[model samples]
Target: MGMRLYAIVIYLFLYLPIGIIVLFSFNAGRHASDFHGFSVKWYGKVLSNPFAMDALTTSVTVAFITALLASVFGTMAALGLQQFKGRFRALFDAAIYIAIMIPGIVIGIATLIALVTAFGYLNPALAAAWPEWLGDAPRLKMGRVSLIAAHTMFTMALVIVIVRARLAGMDRTLIEASADLYATPMGTFWQVTLPQIFPAVLAGFLLSFTFSFDDFIIAFFVAGSETTLPIYVFSSIRRGVTPEINAIGTMVLAVSLSLLIVAQVMLRRRDRPAA
Candidate 1:
């Protein structure tokens, strides 16, 4: 009884704020705290707001691209690492885990410094090397490219972990049979290995998209002039909180929960016995 009570208390402590946000999202009042009556006008306002829409578009685009890149590169890395020997494999395993464990602030700062340094050197060199005919050489800077790159690098570790977990449980005999049957490696992967591991890859992609979409720390540093949904919300909150903010939070929460549920379902389905 004591443990149950404690658990309930802990859960409430964690979720009460989220519950409040969801509840107040429908508040008719202009203030976030004062709930005059239930209305969804705030949600409509949020959806119609041009700045918010632009930020949402940016977030969705970046998240989609980030997920795609992370899935592709991470899957490739996971497949390649299977062939690696002891120490090298262990080293890479540590690196992947460390990338995931590292704090977002550290990643954001490091990415910012790295991009700034690289751009400083590359922009000048590129301009110097450019032909006089082409008006001005394009310069590298912290923006969408950097944002996508940072997000991909961070989320790729998650993909590697998920895909590798799937790979570890895969039936090796199927692969052996494919090889014995004189199937090319590429052909075998396309027909056999890929089908088995695809679920995990997809789950990883969804998780990557969710993370990239919700992220503010890394995006804050590398976003340059671009604004993501999280960044926009953060900026908005600096002025004052309103029901619209609550509505935005509720919408983000809904999206994040939906994706998470889908990812969980995919993973569970992957674990089921063959029909």
Candidate 2:
């Protein structure tokens, strides 16, 4: 009975706030504070906010870029280090840990500085050759690109960790068997090794995507003028919580949660054996 009550207490503590927010999302009033008769007047407000929509678009673009870059780099790094053991291998592991375990503020500041410094260090030829879309210096200091880069930097270590674990779980016999079949290194990797890891790579992509989407701290520091959903919500709170905010929050919560669930379900199906 005590344990049951304890479990119940924990559940309420964790989910009660979510329940309140969700219940109040359809609120007729702007803030959840005073109960107005239930209606979705606020949900319509979320759609009508032009600034909010721009912020949302910018955030989504940045996060998409971040997820793509992180997945490619993380998966490649994991694959390269998978069959290795030695001093450098251990060093790489420690680096991954440091990347994640460091304070977010510190990382954000470092990233912001690095962006400026890197722009300075680029050769004139390199800078000239750079695509027109790639902004220079402090322009890099803020905006969609900055937010994406910040999120990617913060979430990269986690991606490496997940992909590495999945690789470690992979069957070594298949790799050996491919080699024994006289398949060339590149061919074996493409044909035999990659298929086994596709699910893991996909999982990492979704994980990184979700993290990049929801991040607030690094976004607060490195995000120039554009606001992500979390940042938007935070800023809105200063003006006092309105039902419009809750409506946006409810939509964000719905979309994010749905993606997560669908990703998990797909992963599970991928893992299961065919009859």
Candidate 3:
């Protein structure tokens, strides 16, 4: 059928480049395109490359911290938003969706400008206020901390949306029964509410980690001196794409796919009907 053919074409269009990268990752030749034979020397080289390992370490650290902060804060925001009434709730709902819809480039540029402006003022003021004994007051700048904050701010919206969706489907009677039993609000949350929404939160955390790890646009602007895996890959590609780069891309793809699968499983578990 024409429709089936069209769908096949679309699928190939979307994934053919990725498939090429994976297939060529084992290329024995120095060139990525000319695959003389299959070998994983490139993978070994990537693993042994100190710069690549350092960048991977930074990416993992930033993504882990970002996921934790986003999950906690976003869950709290979702809970608090449940109390909003009418227009107020609509306004916030719009804002959260808008944050998710905004382009990564816009966020990166805005974050870069905001950090630069804040540092400009805060650095001078801190210097003026510092005691003479503490040789040189530390100044704020874009780096790992800034990267984490930007990633957390962007990913928190994802967690809020996921948790809120789960909360909407939750059994209200369970919460009501807990309240009727004279349980404290915190007790009700821990016992009755958290148990239901925890899967969504975990899924959100995994998704957030994946996004932060794979991100390049936002990290490119705000990373300062801190290099992430994506940034390193980008830098490498500027020179030329080699088998080493292909191997790195393949590994990144594998990790991203694994996280996505786990997140999907968590979401599926949450959506499963009560046994």
Prediction-by-prediction clash tally: 0, 3, 0
Between prediction 2 and prediction 3, which has the larger TM-score? Answer: 3
Q: Rate the local accuracy (lDDT) of all candidates.
A: 0.93, 0.78, 0.93
lDDT of 1 by residue, 1-275 (tens): 99999999999999999999999998888776677998989989999999999999999999999999999999999899889989999899899888999999999999999889988999999999999899889988888989999999989999999999999989899999999999999999999999999989999999999999999999999999999999999999998877788999999999999999999998997678534
Cα lDDT tens digits, model 3, 1-275, are: 99999999999999999999999998898876566998989899999999999999999999999999999999999999988889989898888887899999999999999999999999999999999899999989999999999999989999999999999988898899999999999999998899899989999999999999999999999999999999999999898777888888999999999999999999998668643
Candidate 1: Cα lDDT at 255: 95
Q: Worst ten-residue run, lDDT, model 2? A: 136-145
Question: Candidate 2 residues 1-275, lDDT tens each?
Answer: 99999999999999898888888987776557777888977777788898778778866777789888888888888888867799999998898888889988888888778876775566565767778787862323456776776777656777788777767767788889989999999999899777877776777777788888788888887886677877888999998877777777777788778878866865674466422
On a 0 to 1 TM-score scale, where does candidate 1 land against the true structure? 0.94
Q: Rank all candidate structures by their lDDT, best first, as comma-separated numbers.
A: 1, 3, 2
Model 3 alpha-carbon drift over 4 Å, by segment: 1-9
